[model samples]
Target: MRNLTTSTFSLSAFLQRTQGKKVVLIYPWSNLKTQFLSSYLDQAKDGILYYRVPGETVNLVDWIDGMLNEFRTVLGDKFGKKTSAALAERIPAHIGEALASDLGAVVKSETILYLDDLDQINFDDEFNHWAQAFVSALPEKLQLVISARMLSRHPWDHMVASGDAVVIGVETRKSAMAFTVDTDDRPQLECYAFGRGNILLNGKPVTTWEGTLPRTLAFFLIDHPLVTRDEIFHAFWPDLSVKDATNVFHVTKRKVNERVTSRIDDDKQYELTQYTSGFYVASEKLVRHYDVQEFQEAVQQALVASDDRREQLLYQRAIDLYRAPFLQTVNQPWANDRRDELRRLYAVALTGMGRIFLRKGEMNRALGFLSRAAREAPEREDVHRDVIRLYLEFGMIHEARQQYDVMEQALSSSMNLQPTKDSRALLESIKARS
Candidate 1:
């Protein structure tokens, strides 16, 4: 990996070498980062979607929306208001249809999607699904470059192994903390609690728990930080004596630590910490990460951001963190309430992001966020109302009325409720305008 064949990775050379392939996964050496690559891709005159996966968690819809913003940036006037609206309206289930329809005409001159900072991100079920469909359905001329800190369970290996992709590497000067797991490399620790449970350390799965106790302990620390032993005992083994629960807790914690840090140096391993309060928490300094923490932080940041643009971006960031329910398969007591709260917060973030876009005059983009919000929380009349208003604002009266009817039906059927007064007023205004 240290072999220095070139000073810098040449995109033109890479493309030329891998002829007729739409997807190219460039596994640059540990020294390589997005800073150098971003400059190279930004120079492309035709088109490019240079998205830096910023957080530990990313939602499929938010990821697609970020890409769409770039697609819109590159296509310019060709992707006008109506086209943008149409593209934004595409559901996550039909994102391929939306991308192909919007980009078919613009990808004639070698459009590229540079997904930077791949190691800092985790793919949820939606991301995995969209990525496969998006890549497979892409036009022959479109190219994709995924730059990650380390590789895990993404389909890049299959692409390379199947002779469908060309993997290139940069010369290693000093290895950065991140790299796409090479033939001999491995990720430090990657855990995904979004859909199904998956835990990887050193590129190996730690999903098979020694018992239910180990899984419970790991997830407890993930949701509740600095939890006291008493909290753990009461939550899981309340029926047992404190001494008994303490024994069980210590045993389970040790097993989880072993799984996470096996074959790794003690100094480098991110293990659980115990305080004088008998509270245990995961060390913050380690290479370990939690999707729930990432998602919550983004949402909190967005909530407090002062600038409109910053808030908009942060809100979208927060929305992206919620890919699935918190520890979807984990049915423990600690997981359930937090899962419901985050789900509610996710809906709020979606609604807020859409409203932000609406205020900025990006009607189509606003509609997209609102539409997703409505889908996420069908019972949230506020989201449905916003979608209807967005359609009316975009001069799509028919779409607005259609959405209103849908919302009305949903409210009546689901909750035995009717639209709120504000929503009824908005619909009346739309009718008046029509």
Candidate 2:
């Protein structure tokens, strides 16, 4: 494992730190995106490139014109010469050949060429050809900064391979992280406690659990943030006396931390399970991603979203994160209770998505999602009615009747009650339509 790189949250810090590299690919991960970038760039003498032109498409020449104009504005260009270049892979060695060679010779101090939203540019090979030429030919006086939410590996694959370009905003994950990167500031650890519980350190999963108790202890700290020492004792060692449990718990916690630390390549130690203020919590210093935290946050945002499209998107994001039942493998009593709670929320999310689709006139997708909700939580009468209505709207009379029967059975088994008057009316209509 290479040494983990650290970066400050300020634009000045980032520019000063990464100025040596030719191409810096930045991801818009934070909320203060456009405004933050614009404010900082206004203070610097740099070449600007924007990929927006309302009600019209921008071609290669337009982009080049904008960039050259920016360079002139910043560097005070003395030459007005232009040269023609083909769309072939090969381009001249110097920056824009004759035009940039003049600029490079005059530049005393280094400057920046900032490209905003290069991802949004129109798909044109000729534009890409010139873009590649500009990057490859950059003199030591100027560095290229491409700020994009996403960037495809095109001509860049070679530049990155040759160490001429560097990508700043990226997380190394999966088998790909193994090859070797000189520096990275991506999340060094992440735990997805939902579905089958798993832990990853330095982009590699710690797949083996040497003991059951250690694994369960790890989940306990993650599942219930700020867990009390007493609660941990009660959950894992209720039968054992307090004196005995405390000793055992401490030993187990240390083992879990050691196992977690061993997997990471960093020489500096990190506490996977941090104890603070009479409570046990995950480490605050360690950079990490928790899927459970993301799922809950998305659901909370979707519930309050004012726009329908935004609401639908947030709910979809939350639903997609739930790959399976929470903690499916662990059968501990405490795990079971938390699992049940998360499962209920999952059903609610599914029902919410089903109704959202129904509102958009997508009856088939609505029915499919509503049916899954019914399976996970049969007691939801509203979900059943929504599914039955979609089936009836699609002229599936028999299926509607079958769904009504399932709803009736669920209510009978769970609550010993009949469907409401409004639902019964829908049932009677299903029979009449048949």
Candidate 3:
């Protein structure tokens, strides 16, 4: 009989048991799916039933069919001919007559159905039906296990509501650290928290700096922790003369030293170390935390995934990982460049998301997402191009023309280049429509 309560520890123990029972393991994100499946398979008994849901391409029927075929292939090798064939054929109707008769004949043992990447399956009415059917079809001695990112408002939620399902929550806190400027001028201590809110320092509740200019500078320094003071001064005072900016930097450095240098050990270097022309913070000791690293890793992973399933999962993971803009409260020149880089990457991610939506025939959502991306990165001609193309495809002439104008101005001003042939053609097409 299935237990109605599930925890990671309990599930781990349950999977290790030799007694065979029907088990379903549902995985959400694709990146972790294979790793989890391999672990489970290691503990699985011989003749264990295994089913893998393909990436987003396969529909429910195909997914089910594929599972039965795989079961047949694996079970046929182990359980001999008769049992393998029976199990494969009865897979589709496991809870009905076939499984019942087969179990009666073969001293019913455990059947494990591992469903990796359950999140790929859209949680619609049809999915709920399939889930219910699959669960009810299991034998009396069967144990089912489903794992996904979250079951909230999902078909799995309904399963939990009913007595047959057990729900378990895994609290995975992304690692993060907070930095406070000590009187000693060193990035002395680190703070950790569950999320991106205020970071605690030495058991005292500390809020992230809120003032506009100071916060901006702080973020810039954090983003390019190794950036030279000259680079930062240039970024902040781009319109000012270099000599003037250097003078300001010297005064500013003195003020920062007065305020933050007291806590630093005389032997230890300051947070902003002196380089020949300017200063830089060492990357190693910066008081940052886990979420930032997680997001950066996810972004790199997504970029590597390109257009594959892993890429989609990585994009989602990155989105979830990013809580706020790079040092949301900070505005210094160092911060601006980092913020710009992040915004650029964010626009690219949005464009990728729009393409996925477009492939799914979700035209409205695709256009909306692309439009927002374009707006966020108005200076990016590529982003505008994407918006224009999507709008043209959707027959939104006015919107397309507006994007063309924005693109034209942005390219001319920011890049000192005209729109490309493709962009011009798109603009002409919209103009013709108008």
**Top lDDT model:** 2
Off by over 4 Å in 1: 1-50, 53-115, 119-188, 263-270, 392-419, 427-434
Taken over the whole model, the C-alpha lDDT of each candidate is 0.63, 0.65, 0.51
Q: Candidate 1, residues 1-434: lDDT per residue as tens digits?
A: 12222234445654576677666665432233332343243356345656666664355556555656665665674563433454466554467555655666666776776676566545655556656766677777777777664555466667777776666543221223222223333334445666665666555667666887787677676556557778878888989998888788788888877766663555555464445446565453333445555455445555655566556655765565566787787786667876777787788888888888877888888888889888767888888888887787678899888888888888998899989999899889888988
Better of 1 and 3 by TM-score: 1
Q: Give the runs in model 3 whose Cα sits over 4 Å from its true position.
A: 1-197, 201-205, 208-288, 321-324
Reference-based lDDT, residue 154, model 3 = 57
The RMSD (Cα, Å) of candidate 2 is 12.3
Candidate 2 per-residue lDDT over residues 1-434, each given as its tens digit: 11211111255656665756777765431122222233344455234333222223255545544555555654466433443232122343322454455546665666665665465556456545655766766788777777543466765667778777766532222213111222546345667787788877755677766788888888777667667898888899999999999899888888887777788745756677577788776575445556665566456556665566556655775676687878899998998887777777778778888888888888788888889999889889988998888888889999999999999999999999899997899999997998
State which candidate, 1 or 2, has the greater lDDT: 2
Once fitted onto the true fold, the runs of candidate 2 whose alpha carbons sit more than 4 angstroms away are 1-187, 265-267
Task: Assess candidate 3 and give its lDDT.
Answer: 0.51
Error of 3 at 117 (Å): 18
List clashing residue pairs in candidate 1.
Answer: 149-179, 150-179, 151-181
Positional deviation of residue 109's Cα in model 2 after best superposition, in angstroms: 30
Candidate 3, residues 267-292, lDDT tens digits: the string is 64444333433546533332333334
Error of 1 at 64 (Å): 16
